[model samples]
Target chain A: MKKLINGVDQIVSEMVEGLVAAHPDKLRAIENTNVIVRADAPVQGKVALISGGGSGHEPAHAGYVGEGLLDAAVSGEVFTSPTPDQVLEAIKAVDSGAGVLLIVKNYSGDVMNFDMAADLAEAEDITVKQVVIRDDVAISNPDDRRGVAGTTLVHMIAGAAAAEGKSLDEVEAIAQGVADNVRSMGVSLAPCTVPASGKPGFTLEENEMEIGTGIHGEQGVERRELMQADAVTEELVQHVLDDMHLNDGSEVALMINGQGATPLMELYIVARKAIQLLKDRGIHVKKTFVGEYMTSLEMTGCSVTILNLDEERKRLLLSGRE
Target chain B: MKKLINGVDQIVSEMVEGLVAAHPDKLRAIENTNVIVRADAPVQGKVALISGGGSGHEPAHAGYVGEGLLDAAVSGEVFTSPTPDQVLEAIKAVDSGAGVLLIVKNYSGDVMNFDMAADLAEAEDITVKQVVIRDDVAISNPDDRRGVAGTTLVHMIAGAAAAEGKSLDEVEAIAQGVADNVRSMGVSLAPCTVPASGKPGFTLEENEMEIGTGIHGEQGVERRELMQADAVTEELVQHVLDDMHLNDGSEVALMINGQGATPLMELYIVARKAIQLLKDRGIHVKKTFVGEYMTSLEMTGCSVTILNLDEERKRLLLSGRE
Candidate 1:
């Protein structure tokens, strides 16, 4: 495990400190907690948004904590869900008179903890709403799917709505709509190690890959011989397209997300194939994002996210924030 | 080597195609050339900026090609400089009546080819100016140091000047100033494989690292047992500090650039230590950037860049663009 961290126990705290230190004007950390909030959080009369998960996925929960995005982001241990207390702190730190919305990914631990945090918050007279994002289509059973990179779209669109001073209900509706309309699937060329474990969650032979892998290295649906970039992209995009069930003229936003270690060059190559695939099916890609929006430590792979877009969703997606 | 690429021959072109596809609103490729120009290039009365080098270092020249950045970015084969003719095409495509400026790295091939292209453009009556960025402080002999991640700062600061309607001379001078004031050093834990070669650029033992490695896996000044992130960061930052001779209370911008394969988590860990080291020296870090700006495929490492800042440079760095 040749990772560049000081120690296993300190990775999360140090990372939070480092992030706030780097962007002090934009973000700050809640005392004694792994909760990061916008520097000027708790804007009076504005719905506040919060999301987070394990610490390894950089720029996901915390990176999105700023104007036009998340109001607060809680951090757990790597690949571990945050405690309800941590999530509760995030809720308190960002909730203004308007209320708080928790955008949580659909991992069992995450769902339970965020829900518990919302309950805890509501008990204290804080209006808290929660939306579970289950956008990953890796499993045939949609109910069993894990949320993945499509959650980023939810943050962007819903965050914009909240920033525009939407009521808590309106923001929740926008978030749930995005969660319902988005789908994502990923392939991992390699696995990532949790800092405490110092060993990869899984392993593969030199010439093999795991398709439809979860961000936390959950067992993938299939392990196959390595294929060309186009073939792999085809498999992932086909799964997403089939699940979305869009007609020829369906318009959508596309995101090609790198799984930690993949190069931007390869992500672009993947994006090119994905766009071409969508065009062939008569799907219009209105907005395209290519980068590591969410990641699984230093795993080498990528995910494709497609969000069915309407006028409001498109407008909010493209809207700017301070 | 395990990589998500179509093939060695098509890697550069495909990557370029993919990049432009993902950002059509902001970038376009010159017909039949590997040059990517701002979608609305040749902005009359605004100095056009051009930068390029080997292809492996992505987002270096290309990703920076949007509003407030380079007017055009020329792509070369992986780790190989683009030919003078290719650069000449870039010069031709983005040169409005306001003239053009070429930002070339310190590599011999890049410097030679960009200079040749400038000469060719001058012959065609296009006012062409060039700035050769040599910001790496790894080698004690500054004249022989290779340019590293600091080139990205040159692009950001100088590119903004060009976008603000600065003349070729003004942009060239600002670029030259940035080039002179910036310094960088890097450490690599693992080497990346070139697509054509299908072999790691260099190798490291299971618990070893190379301090002061160049972007292309050039031999580092020191190779030793792997140390904690803080220790490694101290070595790199100390070298940069000593080279820059920044006084206590000096204001500057700092960047922690990932070398493709390092996780963002690790980069922030490194950033925390770097920031503390600078603060302890009374150096005031006005702005900090953390991510992969210029990458070497999938190398597992990072580089630290510090740019001495003045009022003009700080304002430009913070300025906005469409």
Candidate 2:
């Protein structure tokens, strides 16, 4: 109902300005653009990492830009892809002689823009590589598997490798490795995101929820009844565990992220059961991370992601490079 | 409303267990106790740091337990204080011969339980000092000020010093300086938290917001009419700036934190205008952080906090030790 914004339209631009004002030491905002870059760019020898997507997934495409993550991130309006020109400018800003790697989520618009940018940049004599993360197991391909929440792993693995001066070939390889291993699934009981319009995005009836939801406030596969955390987790994790194809005695890394409205306490409760669910199957979970890594604008629910780790993923998980 | 919880009473305990399971390398849950400790606490002769309040602020007491902040944290049930015994156990679990420093938010229940633990720990010859953060500028009476979002700064600044191996007294001095300089104020358009019974904690009709809200879903100072983000930030920042007694040309670290339900884009938009408002008044903002640091469960709104900064405070902030 009530909001603290100047214009419904200027929300993203305004936020970018404030972030630059706050972290000049770590970042800089391009004039009149949705791109934020590290103060140090075109390092002459290292591959640059570029990422961007909708604006609502804060700290995701941008907050993660620092020493170990993205070199530049172009932000679109809430839940929308940055235009091709915006992505093109970002590529121009961060591209070094070493080439640029575009970390893309498997969204149609995102794929189109980044792919176009890659073609443009390559035409300009700058080499570019792109990786599309389709790690969300929530969507079954019986209809069509869609991308959801596991993109964080791809970012970390690729960003870490890029920051370490790894070759584009090596970085893309590691990103592919991580992407192949991670899977995410989400469900929401209520819809609560404040769009740039200064209005809450969607409203769920008092007794309704959109289950198997996506981060953009998109309706899920079904609006199943919202149940207890344990029961919800049981259904969610079963989907993830089965999707990951982890059998008894498998080892993994789990992330239980809030879609905004879920509190810290309940996230932990859900994650606690998720661990037991895995343990009961003799699946050895080596690591776990729980928090709002990537979120839908103030939506209240939690998603569980399991990264079935192998020797390579385990090494990259601990590797603090990017 | 849909929820993912068993009996409401078991929410906090169950969540704590999940956090423990999530980050065994980074955190360890106290056996049969509602406390969490950094896996590598009590390094040789470093002062241990512990902070906790209610259960809703995650990655807070628990989320912050890794490398940069907090050696240990004790969580109370949702909106409740941890028992004194739990505090004592957390203190003992992390206390080295170098002693421990307790950082307590100035909530009445929090103060009493932490102080009770201090007295209990003192009886056992453990040297302990306390820094009570009462920085919410929204509340009147400095002594009666309610600690809000700025309390996180206390934990971080003190946690940095402690990790850098500052003596207990030195850490206390730095934490006190942060506690003295920081101020926070919160607003909410709704009140919906999970009670152990898995029901909404408080209800706010659409278009109604509780101004000057509290962390545990406390009734706000005024059920005033809600407005745009620009107006919201003006009211909240003005409250903080005035109550903190900051004048023109003051440099502060600004934060526009969501109370769960508000989106980051909207929060950033608000921060944009708030920054403009301050600049117009001749104040220089040295830093800005916009996200959901402390949240009211599923409430759709944002809060603003400012921490006055000097060279020393800035140094302490920039110097984040392992």
Candidate 3:
């Protein structure tokens, strides 16, 4: 209700307009469509990369569209999956002769829609491949684990590979490699209200916090009394390390992500604990990113993602162009 | 307060520790001192640029320290100014043979303390000059205007000048010129709770908001009901334009800064409006930065900063070296 949008129906459209308008040289929104493609998309002989999902998470799919990232991003209404046609438009807009690769998060809706888009692209004789990122360590069922911040890492690695003129299969393999190695877990201090709903999806007592909350305000594994910053971060970090089988001497690229509404100060505090704990376990941190990469529409909390790094993965991850 | 912090008394120290830990290659903390310096500090023959303020504003002073932005940043406790000795220590640590330039926000504590530090540096035979940025337009008296987000512009420009090997006087003049030309104003949807204070700085009804609120929750010019996003952005943009005396064909760098808790979605909405309105007036936007450049600790709202640019500033502002 307190959101600064004119109407819930216009949130996605207006946001796409604003994003393309803000970065005219870097991005372009397809006419009358909720798809944003790089201004110079469809580079000849280069594998194109496309990704997208719900609208509330700004800078995730769209903000990453540039030279070294996604070639296109399709957006849905807030917290809702984009229609298959929208994804198809993005695919068609960015497909070069080399082919196209889609990075879909593991959410059921996202996976279904992106897969349909790939099918549509294939019908047009466009060579297309897809990888579903299931990186959240919170869910016990691997098939049910929803992608979180770690999906951004997948986009970076896969996008870089595509930008390097790799074959569609090569890009797909790297995307899947990142998907298999990355793990993320989040904690929420409060719930977020979708603009259309104007009501919180869920509620928590003032003294309680949710561990492993979904980006859309889905119930976490547990809601418990708030703990200190280090303790909360320790829980998420341990979950990720355990889930990924990262042991002593493992190297990683750490992402300390704020789930919308969390401040950089708190994110750094969480990062401090994460880094210290990882060091204690003799894990080497190759790179550290601390900021809001993915968000949950003003929900308060943080997520920690660790991408186990190999030479190829590290090269592509660090190869971000912009 | 639902903040992710351990001890309020240790927040500043711990945050700095985390920052340096995460960016060990780029930054380092002065041992036992609340100061962050570039890892390769005291670059011979390069004018050193330093800035600092209260600790709560993460990424302002410290985060800006890098190759082409700042050489050193001193930190005070939360919402408190660093003492003169702390500033003096920063000056000493980063003073190359060329000189040192101090960029101080126009808070009473900061001005007095930095001036004292400048005097201390002179006593120690270190060539030092200072510029106090006054960019907020809400206050009627120019002398009383508080430096808000526009201080970042001063840093970018002056630091670039210093890094470009400009003379001490040249860098000071450029910084002062930026401070004089830039204008900023903010609106807050909710009050922030400082960790040590464990309570909101001020309270607002659910539907209420504050215009021209200071970065540290200082009282703004008006407390009013929230309006549509465009209308709010229009008011801020008009105020800044009026204060800057900008007109048709003016070229400027626009910054849509989110006060920590505001989501990027809202910031982009605000940026959309700001850009459209400026274009309506035939103003040419040379560059646009939309993000949490400077922030109030988890305060929900945003600020708009416009730096009317001349050729020198246009070049220097765009001269950020990573």
Candidate 4:
């Protein structure tokens, strides 16, 4: 595999170092851990919002760390979950009087570790509340759904509430509200290579695509022959709309997120079809973002996220804090 | 071969349609033409800036069309220059009484077509000036150098000046000055495939890399065994510093641009090394941008651009218009 890393084992720490160096005015790394926090963390009156998982899905948990986004992000190795101790350090670093909120994606490893971290923080009298995001509509069973790009939306809502100096209970409720409303589905044309493995987790023929794939190169709902851009986008969007019960006249926010290697041109193409699909069904798209907000290494694919927005959610969505 | 385009022949138009639909608040396309203009074009009494080339290098010409960037961008097919008529239409649509400026890359086709368009615009009593950017230090001959990612910096500088109501002559001079001061070099691990061709422009084995490939997937100066990221970056950076004659205490703005498929993690790794290298050489990096600014379709590689900045250029660079 052709990766620009110094050593496979050093990917996580080096990436954290590089991120901190590049955004010194906006972010900083914990002294000896894989934890990234806002440059001005521990704001005396604001609640702290922290989220993280593996290292491969970049800009996901870390890149969103800014004034109106995440206050801190705890990272593990690629495709691995961070230890509870690391998450506990992040909570201690960012917690202020208002309390702290943990935005955990619904991966088995991530949920367990973050829960332990929350418990540890609570033991220290740091009121920590956890909002588990399980918004992947591809999974038929709600209890078995895996969190995906929609987690970034949860971060935005919770971060905005925290930045506005909301209490711990208010922030957790608002975050949970977004988690309940958001749904996402993804399609992958190619699999990503983990640096240590130096091989793709899976492979698709030249004309095949995996519909409803998860971010960490997980299997999708179906492997079918490649379809037109519009058709593929329709399938993804349809799943989300149906799962969210977003019908005619339902107002929502849309995100066309790229899974690393996808081009912005293609993302816009997907966005075009998605907006038209929603418009044809009488769904009003109040806000839209199209880019590589969260990525799966160099995987070539995209995810469509729909967040059923209310006044509070919409206000937080367009807060423009970051 | 695995592109998300509808058809090989329709990639350009479809991509333009998608771009306009996604960014309606900031951009619009001229009807029936491969030309994208600012949603608020024809700002009377302000010089207009226009730039264009192949469609593959997105966000270079179109994504930069906002408050402090290009007023219009003409697009050709993938890896192909737009026709003179398309460029002429862009000039006519964005030209206000203050005149217009065209930022042309050093590619032969782009230069010829844009020059023809300028002549056509002149016949219609529209004042037009051209700035040809040829900052690639990879090409030994100064006259034969091809413009690369550094062209975006010219747009940022010229765009800011024009937005500030600078005269046509003033904007053109500032753009030309930036074009002269900037230098860039790139390395590619694989080649990019043009949709019409259905194949990459060239091929490389698993352990090979091109030292200075052009954005069109053209062969670079050397194709040798793959090296570590820092070593490869050192070669590219050394060429720029030597060619530019930048010495100790020189202040420059650095850009570590990903060529489409490269991950943000890798780009940050490159940025870390590039910044450290410059610091060791006693050059001060004033501002830095690390992301996929200009890309070669889906090629896995990156480019480094350094602009030897003066006070005026620094002011315009930090104007943060876009």
lDDT (10s digit) by residue, model 2, range A123-156: 9998999988886665677224545667877777
- Candidate 1 CAPRI grade: high
TM-score of each: 0.99, 0.93, 0.98, 0.98
Model 3: how far is B46 from its true place, Å?
Answer: 1.0
- In angstroms, the error of model 4 at B14 is 1.6
The 10 consecutive residues of candidate 1 chain A with the worst lDDT sum are: A313-322
Residue B316 lDDT, candidate 4, scale 0-100: 92
Candidate 4: misplaced stretches above 4 Å? none
Root-mean-square deviation (CA) per prediction: 1.1, 2.6, 1.1, 1.4
TM-score of 4: 0.98
Best by DockQ: 1
Candidate 3 local Cα displacement, residue A138, angstroms = 0.8
Ranking by TM-score: 1, 3, 4, 2
Worst 10 residues of 2 chain A by lDDT: A140-149
Cα-based lDDT at residue B62, candidate 4: 84
Fraction of native contacts under 8 Å reproduced by each candidate: 0.73, 0.79, 0.63, 0.52
The 10-residue segment with the lowest total lDDT in model 2 chain B: B192-201
DockQ of 4: 0.68
DockQ-based CAPRI category assigned to the predicted complex of candidate 4:
medium
- Which pairs of residues collide in candidate 3? none
lDDT per residue for candidate 1 within A113-211, as digits (tens), equals 999999999999999999888988888898888989999999999999998989999999999999999999999999998878888999999999999
